[model samples]
Target: FFAGNGNFYTFVVTATTNGVVNINIPAGVAIDYQGNLNTASNQLSRTFGNEYPVYTSSNSGGTISPVSASVGQGLTTSFTVVPYSGYTMTVSGCGGSLVGNTYTTGAIVAICTVTATFTQIATAVLPTVTTGAATSINMNFATGNGNITNIGNQVNSKRGIVYDTSSHALPGNVAPASSSYPNKVEEIGSFNTGAFTENITGLTSNTTYYMRAYSYNSVGYSYGGEVSFTTNIYPTVTLSGYRIFSNINTLNVGTALEAQNTAHVFSNSGDSFRLRFLLHIANSNLSVNGGVFKIQYSLRSGTCDTSFTGESYTDITSDTPVAFYRNFFSNDQVLLTTNANDPTHNSDTVVPQTYVEKNNFSNAIATVPMGQDAEWDVSLFDKSVMDSTSYCVRIIKSDGSLLSGYTVIPEFTTATYKSRGGGGGSMYIENIATPGGTTTGGGSGSGSGSYLTKCSDGIDNDGDNKIDALDPECHAGGTLQGAYVPSNDSETVAPALPTGGCTQNCGGGGGGGDLGYWIRTVYGIFGSQFLRNSMMGSVIVSFR
Candidate 1:
């Protein structure tokens, strides 16, 4: 024993008995204590089987995995605790302290308590769903707003998005399952203090989705408030046929038609020069209101203004894709018989037969939906090219956006063949003439003259609307049915029908004969090539 006043002190006591011992020190024996030594009178002894510094360990709120510890003198025993899900651990009570999740006992001879106190885990705050796109979406989340405040035992954290056709609430056990891509919830790994975003793909197009962001911790998931979005949809389109008009279509009227086969384009000024197409609309359900019917010309025998840079359509596997909308003109277009009585023929009814057409010619649009036909018309503002260029048509979206691939081409043409009597569907003078008629039309080229097929111009030549061929007075005895030769020409006796065709062949001298028979001989002289050049005015036609 050592005291603060360092005086020499010594004690020696021989054992009276081996198993037990008793010691008695007088009251004045220790001055520091100022009393007798009580411990010298009594004693306790240990004779157990395991005696050299025995050690033990334990914990609460969690499990110490290897609780059965070694009891060795100066030997360290390692102990680990297994926390239940959200539970954590703490070591105390005598033996050892915990480093991380492990507890190593100190050099000791006593048992100790390793307490593992478990509490709920706090996950991140609910996430925010930012945007939704075709087949994918963007979601975000953050920490610090979770339900579980126990940050000490946060084993792990993750962020991600959850979505479905319907609503999904927080703390839910079930989530949406899509047959589409990314069939499950997307989870981003743990992050601190910053934003988190995850883009999930394979979402369906044009579908509305309910979505939210989510955070997870050792405890459970915390969700962001609900959000939703829908994708955009584009409709399909298709076209069928178109109608032509030389004049305004009367309003509220059913089916106003103009030239179907042979539409005219006279090269002279102050002549009828108007035409517009009313295309039949189909698939109105897909009316994106983003399309137009554009027509480009391919001119020939007909004359055009010099500055005209004719359009050329290319790139198709077969024929080039020209701007031909609706049904096209075919060879079936015969010479249009100028019949003033024809309901479809309006050039005759239009006042001031010499009045020039300078206005755009088109009709009111009709509703074109599926299972029903409607009209989308194009006003042919420029007419010089139509006289020769053939047409071709195709379907294109209003925005000119692609559908699958190439534009589908339909049958189309603008070649006006000569009809039997200038019939409604007959070709304009461009591709027609009576076998021996002195007029050639169409790509065959044209001939200029007032020397029309005198009998078929459909004009009341002598000041009457009752045209020739049909008017009884126009039969032979009327004013000259031949080309109107200026009255100043000398009168010549009408010659007999010589041999075959020529009854009146002028020999360069200014003379007049039966103009009807004069033109027949003109037919024999010029043939078909000379016939195509005929560009007479105030044309009319009869319809079936």
Candidate 2:
């Protein structure tokens, strides 16, 4: 039985005979839109526009017709009253109905007609859930007479549920955010677009989840359909630093410097560059030394702006105990001159050598030493130079014969050593004394010093009777290497003489420590060798 007309109750009809249809409405009962009872009316009804009717009829010696009713229409509605049996009642607000009549023992009998209503339950639609995506679904309801309200609790409870199973609406309600880079839950938005989303983060690489949506209205809670999705896979690679090398074994200074410049100039050169990888590592410090380092770099098919050359060398192996960083070392480099006979080149063309494949610094820095002549000579490429057609300077290896990295500076051009002054070449010697020291300068050339010598006379000045160039003991060579003087070798009154040779022996030296007598001797060597008795002694020497 079901409620009808707010107070009327209708009984479900069962077939009595093969051709007889029975309609039974219980007295004083009504059916609400749902299965609940509505007691306001003892009559139940519905109206059909132009499509309501008992189109087909099965009769066991009976006749049937339609009927109607309305609200507050009080009538003792029973299951046996029929219109064909002369039972009539007027009730307003009622719609389609049915009436039936039968004849029994030559007497007419009528059966009452009953109406039944069907209503639908409300429901929601759920969207598919992904491991790293925003999710949402809609909530909806179905009721015969529109009696649902307040749909908040159901949707909010399961708003973020992103996983599901047969028994559970979502096996994993809480999932990682959509962006693992930022790694956090983000409440994006919840509009009428049929979903409420909260971004999840920190998800494992490859995983899956199931999800469903739920909603609540004034009527009841409703649920949406379930969905599932999977995440993608990624590689597990750990990237550190890079290393470069030239000439194979020794730490290539230019290669290491280029790797450093790649970071600053190129910006896209990852963290490191390498060649002939001696050791590849990370997390440790690195350094370079021991060669004339020249950094040659161009702006990707453009012009190169600067060059470098190492002067002094230092060894900077890892300071830390651990060798976690890469190490690169290369042999020293030698520059080739085009004017001279070629060593590393054939005719005038410089052949390229083996590719450098490692980074010299574990930290990716080109450590240039101090006082190095670090500059680049730009090649002026006027149309006139192209017309003349020449080559540039080339770089050679330490063996005076080995071929190595690129050499394009001094090959076919006359710009070699122009930017750097040489010939009476600029000597860069280390550990030389500071300026004005006893050791004036340190270089490849020899040095000079000052000394003193005795003057000679025609007389037996020292009583040895030696005179002029003929004196064996006094005159041996033309000039003295270094010596001290004594006025005892000459009797000459002194006037300060300009520096020059003595008349007799320019090579001979005298015992020193005589001040006045030495002054007299120098005066006599350059002027008159005649000194009074007051000036006669040895001399002390000093260097200027």
For residue 239, give model 2's deviation from the true position in Å.
13
C-alpha positional error of residue 10 in candidate 2 after TM-score superposition, expressed in Å: 73
Candidate 1: lDDT over CA atoms? Answer: 0.34
Give me the runs in candidate 1 sitting further than 4 Å from their true place: 1-236, 247-284, 287-295, 299-368, 383-395, 398-544
TM-score of each: 0.23, 0.18
The local lDDT score (0 to 100) that residue 436 gets in candidate 1 is: 35
RMSD of each: 25.1, 31.0
lDDT of each: 0.34, 0.25
User: Relative to the unseen true structure, what is the Cα RMSD of model 1?
Assistant: 25.1
lDDT string for model 1 (419-538, tens) is 212211212211123323332122212222232333333223455433332233433222232223222121222112325332221111122122222332222222324322331221
Score residue 100 of candidate 2 by CA lDDT.
36
**Model 2 weakest lDDT span, ten residues long:** 138-147
